[model samples]
Target: MTARTARAVDVPVAGGVLRVGVWDAAPDAPTILAVHGVTSSHLAWQLLAEELPGVRIVAPDLRGRGQSNAVAGPAGMAAHADDLAAVCAHLDIAPALVVAHSMGAFVAVVFAHRHPALVRRLLLVDGGLPLSAPADLSPDELVAAILGPTAARLSMRFADTAAYLRFWRDHPAFAADWSPELEDYLVYDLVPVADGGAALRPATSYATTVEDTVDMNTRPTVTEALDDLAVPTVLVTVPRGLQNETPGLYPPAHLAALLARYPAVEHVAWPEFNHYTVVLSRRGAARLAELVTAQLSLSVA
Candidate 1:
């Protein structure tokens, strides 16, 4: 679909239909199920999809985000995993190579564990393992602790799409990797909302964000899934974080400890990319494309 232009397909899920963006390849082509970050939509994988033109990438707007924003109820690792399972069943694609970014990585781990027959392997970009934080924090506290300004932005209403684009354009993480394609993804994030006047808001549900963020770091579903996980998996991290600050999501010591605990998951780092750029930027997406091709080779070999 990257070469032919992408299209949307809705698949029924828990509370509503999950909106999936399909990038076409020949029917016989290998498929990649890509999962985006906490607040991101399927469009986050557009660059990566285009890079691997020969691959059919099915990226879904996880319930409570993107076009699936109306999807209701619980939003945790297991819930997201089941939503993914529904998408795969709807497409009749089992044993697909799963490539997930940020919180999506957490979902993939559980998905693979719960539906081992469906996922062949995983390429987790920028997130999957737990972050360094107190285990006793509440979902709201955790969202504030982990997301910081990102969580704050969700409450801010914008006059129009241009204002939202400007908000991201000024972000330190994206300052150097900005592109028109990136703008399209940003625009898609906005949805009209009644906030005192004519205004727009990010489609991501803050309540869902809190629930999922808390579950990723504090709940046993993620860590337990990781403990029992047998699928072949690789985790790739960047040097910078969401705002392009040093150390990124997983600092050296924290990352080393995680690797020691889950030696089954291989680790790799990309010095030139940040958390967001690893999937949204051109050069970073090219590097990711190379990794996907290599993983597909391993899956077949």
Candidate 2:
């Protein structure tokens, strides 16, 4: 069966409401709580939703990103985890499988730990493992260095949506895998600035992005969750980083050590894809759908 168009919903939470994208399959179909990256919106799961027609996919535009950019209070792993729990409570889904990408993976880990009863499994895509950081850099500097161009774009202003699309079209990571779905995702990220001009700016808050980046690196919640992890988790890594460069976020040796420490966690490497393409590309989404479907079957068995 072909997937249906996604429906948007606003779920109330502490401080503000979270805008969620729902790909409803059936009333009783297995639910997957998908989460996007730091700079992404719920639309990131569009391709994945199409790949799994029998499963219901729910993704939220986390506070400080996408349509939920106005959410109040601080942005951190703990706060995000709490918000996710509230979302699950609002949806009334128990033991849901969570599929998270990039920084979303960090949030998923903490959510599984904080609300163990709400999550049955975790699918971490290209994130969640401890990253190597320079101890000398401050939080702000760390964020700048880690995010690179992705962070730089937040401070920039575009003449129009077309200009923003042009910028992304030139990006090394997305240039080769460009598609209408990706264009839609980028278009949704743009918000009109109030300078009495036609130019638009990114919806993501710079302060929130910096705060979350720092928290992801220094937060104890992620490490604590890993230490006491009881949920079955699978991590999928790509061979390229955000810039489409080789020696991706998790190097082979680094991942091997991480797996050794967390022996219960399963790891899979997709050499053909990159950090962004893992969920944005057709092949990558298909592979992820297979994993989600297999896990859903296990959950019911």
State the lDDT of candidate 2 residue by residue for 1-301, as single tens digits.
2555789989898889999999997788889999899899999999899888988998999999999999999889989999998888898877468999999999999999998899899999999888765667887789877888899899999999999999998989876788888899899999989687888999999899999998888768788989999988999999899899978888788888999999999998888899999998777788888999888887887
Candidate 1 deviant stretches above 4 angstroms: 1-4, 195-197
What are the clash counts of all predictions, listed in order? Answer: 3, 0
Best by lDDT: 1
Instruction: Output candidate 1 Cα RMSD.
Output: 1.5
Q: Worst ten-residue run, lDDT, model 1?
A: 1-10
Taking all chains together, the TM-score of candidate 1 against the true structure is 0.97
Q: In candidate 2, how many Å is residue 280 off?
A: 1.0
Candidate 2 accuracy as TM-score: 0.97
Stretches of candidate 2 above 4 Å error? 1-3
List RMSD in Å for every model shown: 1.5, 1.2
TM per candidate: 0.97, 0.97
